[model samples]
Target: MEEFVPSAAIAHFVMKVKDVESSYAFYQGLGLRGIDKFPEMAIIELRGGTHLLLAAKDDPMAGALHASRVGQRPDFISEKIDLMIAGHTRADLEKYRAELMANGYSPADIAEAPLYGHDYFSMLDPDGHGVSVYTSHCGDKPV
Candidate 1:
């Protein structure tokens, strides 16, 4: 009998936003092409075949989805969520940072980490979720 190896990959990343439409617009401005849209939810495609699901806080499914995490704390605030995006090269990371800045997004200044062997920049989405753009070192060599 062959051992079953799980092929794991991120299919969708769901996030609760205060206003679905506004948050959708925010992501659209960042070059994420919208794949589907609904009154209380939206699906945006990222670069690496992963989809971002944005759900309105007031949506019923959103409530149920986060119910376990919230427990009895109705006022519980979600801890900072990091959405890391990878670029093909260091220049690609810098280009994304520059484009974000030019489009009025105030991303943190780019920084390099020797330990990680990559360059990265961080920014906050409309709902204050952390979004980071980076170029990885332990992957196919950059073109």
Candidate 2:
């Protein structure tokens, strides 16, 4: 038997949104660049090489796409998905949180978690997906 290995890295993540335009605007507000627009989908480029595809849930193509996946399609709008982004330092995380707040994003109060060994904050997108920005470790604390 041979070990299975993936041929390539993940190029993008597809999020089935109730409204593509609203989701696109929400991500754009978070600083993601809109690369392309389609009738029922919008492509957004994040900081890294990965991209985010916001597709309208009711699009005809959505059914075909969901069928190809292993499990039932997730309800992205109301799902509890934690999209975490790493920050270089505590100050960096703090700055990001502040920026979101300044830009009309109401992120929850920052919290320190001993179990995770990090300080993090979370905010909800327009579709209600949870996005978290966190430092790997609490200041001077071991993971």
* Candidate 1 lDDT, 1-143, residue by residue in tens: 56553376577777888888888887888888888888888998876567888988778867755655444455645423444445656678778878878888898977756226667777788888877666665454321
Model 1 Cα shift for residue 77 (angstroms): 1.8
lDDT of 1: 0.72
Clashing pairs in 2: none
| lDDT by residue for model 2 (1-143), tens | 56554466567677778778888888888777899988888999875457887878789976765666577445433543344445655576778778888988898887865236566777777777777666653233222
Residue 53 deviation, candidate 2, in Å? 1.3
TM-score of each: 0.74, 0.74
Query: How many clashes in each candidate?
Result: 0, 0
